[model samples]
Target: MSRYVVSFMKDVLGGNGRQIEVCQKTLEIDASSEGEATELAKQKFCKVEHLCEWSLHADRIQIKSADFTS
Candidate 1:
């Protein structure tokens, strides 16, 4: 299994009147691949936020590997 960081982001107007992506929440998940991590994160995120779907709260989802090496 690999660790992954899943970030939920939403687009909103900034102070400068420009659209910007804001991170609403982030979760760390362990899965076999990026795709698996994404699905797992989505389910967990929706359940935690009490939403029927992930998109209901977040505009987009980002997934990245969390493993680091020297």
Candidate 2:
């Protein structure tokens, strides 16, 4: 198991100009399989429209998996 950082880039809401904002979040995942990690990340952060555009970067230090971490 390992941790990963998902970075998001999306259009900024309530802005006068057409600008994009970048956001980042970290997820601790079981690297035992790629599917597990992907699923875990989606479940945790995919609820929001902006976060759904996130892409995983480097893995981080491991932490215990949770049902939800918000």
Candidate 3:
């Protein structure tokens, strides 16, 4: 079992057509392989751009890169 940080950008309901947004969050997951992690993230977010392994320090996971999507 390992923690991961999933960061992604998407358009949410707002004014002026579609607005670009960013979402970064930490998740605690357990799986037999990385493939399972990917699948879990996909199922949770449904539109995740990047899902990377993360280290849990206290109660926060530092975000590495969250500029891949926009």
Q: Which stretches of candidate 2 lie over 4 Å from their true place?
A: 13-16, 46-70
Q: lDDT (CA) for every model shown?
A: 0.94, 0.48, 0.43
Per-residue lDDT tens digits of candidate 2, residues 1-70? 5554433333454466665553445555556555666666666665543454334422232334344556
lDDT of each residue in 1-70, candidate 1, tens digit only: 8999999999999999999999989999999999999999999998899998999888999988999977
lDDT of 3 by residue, 17-64 (tens): 765453445444455455565556555543342323322112222323
TM-score of every model? 0.90, 0.38, 0.33
Best by lDDT: 1
Error of 2 at 70 (Å): 32
Q: Regarding lDDT, does 1 or 2 come out ahead?
A: 1
Q: Show the lowest summed lDDT stretch of 10 residues, model 2.
A: 53-62
Better of 1 and 2 by TM-score: 1
lDDT of model number 3: 0.43
